[model samples]
Target: MLSMLRLTVITLLLAPQLAGAESLVSSLSDEAIEITSSFTGSRIVVFGVVRDEQETLDEAEYEIAIVVQGPESEIVARRKDRIFGLWINAASQPFFKVPSYYVVHMSENFSLVASEELVAQYKLGLANLNFVRSAYSPEARGFADAVIDIRRRENLFAERPAAVAFLAPNVFRTTFFLPAIVPVGTYRVSVFLFRQEKLLAAKTENLDIAKTGLSDNIARFARAQGALYGIMTVGLALFIGWFAGVIFRRS
Candidate 1:
């Protein structure tokens, strides 16, 4: 309740600034996400407002796309082949600049209404994402398909059409879920405004997903001192084994 009130107030205060051009502005419900031991999942709400010169245009005349994207990574997709009745990796394709998580929400049915060329130009879908090493073999549904399928099944990527709901004439909002396994990194939330299927204005905001509490300290240490972490793990294992042997011998 409070968050919505705050958003509404902020939007009202910022409306005067967006009057000159086809202005687009947006905000996130939470700028930062903290991952703790008990964090199961979280929801992200994106609030936006589109302003234009025309006063009588209905909300239906505008097409809005809200995208939440996580950090970039290089992913490898491997194909398994049966060799002597054993499944093993036979071929692999590397995907560069892959987002750890990605989801797009649209105000209308963009897939049916928008042209392929326009969609590609805007990079609205997973298929339109920039790929450096693309094994785009449609017949085999190769690496691109494999990567998309895996991410979708894991709830790391999605495409939602007609998901943006209007709050007022120019005010709108969209929501997306972050799974328990959401990657910890800086994310980008982008809101795009379109009219007659043409992009007019765009806005972006940053979101940080991070570990907290004892878990955060451990993760920081592990990442900063990988060799020391490995050595400590081996030492702990040895100590545990020795202690177990001594207890068994006494028994």
Candidate 2:
């Protein structure tokens, strides 16, 4: 309750600065997602209304783009080179403040809706995402590409150019998917309104993905009592091994 109130206050405080453009209001279908053992994947619907105070936008003049971003974390990407019939890490780069998961949905192809500079400014697409490296290196770009490739293969980062659809006048929506292996953390949903390739307004919403039930308890225990948990894990492994050996011997 308090957090929601705080968010409302912050939005109100920021509204004055955004009054000249179309005002966007957006919310998620679900504010919190609970993951369980049977979890496969989840879908979230972003529903929003755009208000053009002057009523100036025409049917084909406006566009919408929505991006869902997971929590930022550090990621390291390495390059391998084969030497003497052995593969070893040759180059590495550390990326800071990279989204663990990212997906963007747009009313049309980003290139069709906005200029390359505008899209790059917003970092709306995977190729345009702002990845900060620990230090400059000649192979950093390749390492960045490797990071994106790995995440793409894992279904963590993706883009859909024409995913957002219009429901009625000044209303838009899009669906975003979270894989079963999604990291448990906070996520951000950003909505942008554009007209004739010009940015009009933007809005943001937050959602939380978390573990529940037995899984939540186990995670809490492991975090709160790491040493104890490690000891217990070792003991359990030894007992399981001995029990399996005894059963096989009897057989």
Candidate 3:
């Protein structure tokens, strides 16, 4: 009878921790790549969400990161610049790092990337900026292809409630980017999740880099404007008569 009573007490004690595990879930809601045009180099923003399944916790804590990889020979033409009277060298060569994870890697592909685990007990919350890296290569002047691996950290309770817990499942969102270049085609973006240094899940998506949309429109407009200016030399007039006419229309 005493053993059965102890068993019942233990079950009740472990109930909440187990319940907490069941309720804790994380995910990425907005997962995609954003492309923009620039004269010097390309820029892209990768955004997503880390949601908790159970509402019990005040907030779910996790980290988001990306593993970026691209062509190797493309990295060249490195330069140095002076900042605040100090000589600082900079590179057009591309590399990847996570500020929060404190992990850095350089590779032609996303194979050598690593994640910096956060200190146990603390949780990384929403709006947490994980990683950002930009590279400019001579070959990339025409086009370049790269991959991104997004990861999230999960928390799990340990046997001893006071003891540090283990990491649960890591959610991932991977994708690829291809800057404008010759012979565009569909590119594959792969994503994976790891738990305890082992991959647990994987997913892939395809990105098309065809010449259409705002980038093309803006390029066409710029060319047309430049040509018009060269041929006609038109300029905006600062005439009081025109200004008065515009104000009169609003009244």
Candidate 4:
């Protein structure tokens, strides 16, 4: 009777932990996206489920964040300053390992999802992104913010709160749009699960964006034969201009 009693106590202690041992299983709508002339934009849905669900929890208590990030590149951010009442590019800063594209979809607001340290560690939002340089100065920060503002206006960087939708207690999904100007490379789709400011599970998936058909050929040819490509572009422009004039004259 004593051994059975001990076993019962241990089981009771472990029950809650076992029930809450949830992990994420997720997939992207498209693993590969091809960019063509008609490729204006695309939408990707991240479908996910919490596996090993032994217990049901309040949907309000469950937190999820999904991020889609494009390839990283080094960039120069130039800031314009008003000189004699005319704004001109005055200062420039270089940033390394900055994402070319980044977007976030959150189940809740930033403060409600997790602590500041965890959010910054996981880059759950635009403000938490770690875009930095060797010199951490106020001027550099201004440059970085300028660059981010430009990207945000262009739909390259974004954050959407309450974007994740829960179909069931353990099932959820999110969808985000990729603009027509999305860069061509391998992007990462990251899904994170949180509860009471603690991370429960995380998953990452890869997405490929590449130029297809004539677009690919033209890009490659332009890189390989720069002078020839420039001449061809000029000729095409002139031909289009003359063609338009002739049509208008006839009309």
Candidate 5:
């Protein structure tokens, strides 16, 4: 009887941990996006489910954060200041690796999801992004903020708090808008699950953005024959001008 009781106690102790051992099943609505001349924007929906067995895991205590980041590039933000009654480039800061596009969707406000340390570690918000500084300066902080501000204005960086929607006990979904001016390149969609400031499970999916139709043709032509493309462009402009004049004269 004592041995049976010991076995029962061990099973009871292990049940919760086993329940916590869940996996994430995730996928994007579209794996690849093509931008054409008439392309305005697109909507991407990320959906996933956490399952331990056939049954879905309870997610009331869990928080989800989704980040879609475009390719990284070196960026410089210049600051203009008034000197001799004229605004001039007084200071500049260079960021070594900055994402061209960054958008985040969160289950709730960051503070409610996790501690500042964990959020910064995972870059759950814009303020936590570790855009490395090429050089150090006392004014560099303001420059960094200025860069982020400009990106925000251009809709390249955005935050959508409380955007995650729960479809079922284990399934969740979040959607983000891709702006018309978004850069065409590879992007990463990363989803993180956190519980009480501790990371539980994380998944990353790749997304491709490329030009299609006339846009793709023009880009390829420009790369392959730059001089010819320029000449053709001028010729086309002249032809269009001449055609418009002929039509107006007939009218």
Candidate 6:
């Protein structure tokens, strides 16, 4: 009887943790990225909510993190340099920066949440190039601009919730400002939810910058292309009909 009672007590104790793990749910409001220019730095904002299944737990604590990856070649070179500096060629050191993660606790009463992450600071000289002229002019004109640009880039920060709250469904939002000097390429935004150092949920979104424009003009161009094709089809039919009538009448 005592062994059976002990088993029952253990089952009850472990039930909540298992339920909590399954109950934790999160989602981003907007996962697609929109950028205006490839040469210029831009900002990305993420908004979403986290919800808990159990009503009994009125509050929960969590941590958030943003990870920025450097250019692949640079990252590989850096790793090699760190392992074997002497064997590697004496090239200029590549730049890499990582953001510190944020942690907060919240009660169940709160629902809306937000966070932002600026990625330009992770790379050197990315926040300094003028979005308009950098593509054409690769040289830095003067020292003052370089210094100011570098300073501006270093101050960038990732977005986070204004306040933390309980494990209830809530809206979260964040904004990121990218500088004009950032490279014209793809980037990533990651959101994480942690319960006292243990990661409970996570999401990642990809951001891309186009040299012509932030998002491809596919919708706009598709409509025009459709119309053009329709016109050509009609014109071809008419020509074939005319040629057939001409040949038949003559025969």
TM-score of each: 0.80, 0.81, 0.25, 0.78, 0.80, 0.39
* lDDT tens digits, residue span 74-173, model 1: 8778999999999999988777898999999988645457877777778888877776225556533567887888899999999898888877657777
Q: After aligning candidate 4 to the native by TM-score, how far in Å is the CA of 13 from where it should be?
A: 24
Cα deviation at 132, candidate 2, in Å, is 6.4
Question: lDDT of each model, Cα atoms only?
Answer: 0.73, 0.73, 0.29, 0.73, 0.72, 0.37
Task: Estimate, for each residue in 3-57, the C-alpha lDDT of model 3 and write its tens digit.
Answer: 1100000000111222232212222232333333332222222222223344344
Predicted candidate 6 versus true structure: per-residue lDDT over 1-251, tens digit per residue: 11110000000011123324422233334433344433344444444455454545435544444333212222111112343546554333222232221112122221133211122222212332233123233332233234334444553322223433223344444445555434445555555454443445544455443334533354345467988767776899999999999999999
- Kindly list the per-residue Cα lDDT of model 2 for residues 1-251, writing each as its tens digit: 11111021011111323535566545455578777766677777776666666655566656778888999998777888897899998777778888999999998744475887788788888987778333355578777877888888888998888898777756666777777788989988788777776676788888888877686778889999999999999999999999999999999
TM-score, candidate 3, is 0.25
Q: Model 2: which ten-residue window has the lowest total lDDT?
A: 1-10
Evaluated against the true structure, the overall lDDT of model 3 is: 0.29
On residues 7-123, what C-alpha lDDT tens digit does candidate 4 reach at each position? 000000112232256665455545687777667777777766666445554554668888889999999998778999999998888888889899998885434646778877886
lDDT of 6: 0.37
Give me candidate 5's TM-score against the actual structure: 0.80
Report the backbone clash tally of model 5: 0
- Model 3 spans > 4 angstroms off: 1-41, 50-183, 213-251
- Residue 187, model 6: lDDT of 55
